[model samples]
Target: MATIKDVARVAKVSVGTVSRVLNGSSKISPESYKAVHDAARQLGYRRNAVAQALVSKTSKMFGVLVSDVGVPFFGEMVKGIEEVARQKGLHLLICNGYHDATEEKNMIEYLLSHRCQSLVVHSKGLSDEELIQYSREIPGMIVINRYIDAIKERCVFLNNHQGMHIAVSRLLDSHNGVAYIGSSEDIQDATDRYLGYQKALEDRSIEFNEQWVVHCEPVAEAGYKAIKQLAEQGELPSSIVTYNDALASGVLDYLHGEGIKIPEQVSVVGFDDIELARYLYPKLTTVRYPIREMAEFAANLSIQLLEDATPSVSDEELEFVPKLIERNSAVI
Candidate 1:
């Protein structure tokens, strides 16, 4: 309950001296600093972040908007952001929208109202114009795993195309035909991954077959349903590549129940090498997304944009390439 004034009174110094000492400003003398520290310890004083923000026009807090907090990929990214934020002596406010556009918008509004210095958005919920307008008004804003054309915002994202290329290439090298199980033509990333799948097929002289491709939501149930449907249609491929590990796990379960062997009968590949990939009975072959790197880079860039006069990145498109992780699920 000790305030700056109480510490200043005990230290026999001006309130400004106490403020400067708390901010670690170099202007304070060593004697003043020592006295202020002793008084602070004696009074059990703590700096009031809210008051400091009001005076300095900075909340010293940042917002992180992600698609789903439960997803392991986002968890790693959050950790990376937290690590950087902690190093910078700033706080992070996380908001999970479950991939809902409306929820993302609400979260943005709430963060802005609280005077967050910057925003690190990692979802595809808001439009370019809307984000640009917010950036123009707020201190700084960075987009992650998504792109916006109107704003010259720094975006840290994955190379979905290259990741899928590796997945399909692995499947084709080891097996004859491969099937894709993920979102339909609606989601942007899913479409890009599907295109990567097609490119891999064309590169290796493998004929493209529509029957072998199945579109489903990015969920385990969707994977199960897609496989059952494919079984009924009699067009199951020798191998399958899923959008994420969740669907891949579901596919593995369905195949096991139907007396189908994995890799031996139908090899499988997954994306976003989540922690569960290692724990699974047969380790999952997946694409290792640089989630931590992306998150930290984006967080630091957002801070820079807020503190410096220069913009973070003038270019509109920025991406991080995913690396292939060979494991037990897919054929060697």
Candidate 2:
């Protein structure tokens, strides 16, 4: 309802003086600044964010693109990024790509159109070449959970292969019949984790069997159906490694319904170490994904790139290793 012109007229000062005062320009005298503030408060005047951003060539806003905002994994990642963004007096512009390449590209373009100077993206559908092109276009763009050799310096990712390897190794040590419930998504994480499972089996001289592996969507329902299918086919293993904690929860529920005692009949291990894993009846033994830490690092990296224009990645931060968290679900 109020404008800068009205404030200037009411304050008996020129529009330029009002503008200077609003922008916190030190050139304005104390008298003019006080008068402008008093008039703005009386008139209920507010500064235009878009106009100010245009003048400064940037906004105090950061962008984040995630697969799904509702998923706990992305929720934790956002929390991490938001923590750093809040400390910097910046706001976040969050968008969900829903694991679609076209949708991911659109979200990135939207953020760029809004003049977002820094971005932390969790993209699984976009190809390496497309992501590389984006990295070249935006120096402040940082990729999380995936790696591209061309833009390695801008990537904050975990060693999924090593994580699965450790999980499978622990399961195989005490159980001869080990199975894998993997994600059917055509993402790098799924592929690397499957390979890790195989590698761990090879290390222990255990023969790999395709029948023992089940691939489906990385969700609780898929996990439930996969386990049921394995049971029907008479291919259920003595122990199983799941793609994530959500899947493990489903397996636990199905096993419990069938009156199967965990660690005694069928041991289960999961990845990501999500909060739900701890609350499960037979608390999950899992690999900690450290998504929050990686997201925080990625957010800070994006800001550093904007500030220094030539940001360097530290060895410690770039390559995060997953840790094994033993719990009630698995046995020695």
With a 3 Å backbone cut-off (N, CA, C), the pairs that clash in candidate 1 are none
Q: What is the TM-score of each candidate against the true structure?
A: 0.78, 0.83
State, as a TM-score between 0 and 1, how close model 2 is to the true structure.
Answer: 0.83
Off by over 4 Å in 1: 1-58, 149-153, 311-318
Tell me model 1's lDDT, rounded to 2 decimals.
0.80
lDDT of 1 by residue, 1-332 (tens): 68889999999999999989977899889999999999998996655343345467757787888888887888998999999899988888998876667888778766765667767886666666766766665556788886555653566677788899888987888788888887763556787888899999999998998887788788878888888888889957789999888888889889989988877888888898888988775888888877888888888888887668475464533577788898888784
Model 2 lDDT tens row, 161-268: 999999899888788868899999988999999999999999999999888899999999889888888888885789999999988988999999999999799999
- Pairs in steric clash, model 2: none
Instruction: Provide the lDDT at 316 for model 1.
Output: 33
The true-versus-predicted C-alpha distance at residue 218 of model 1, in Å, is 0.8
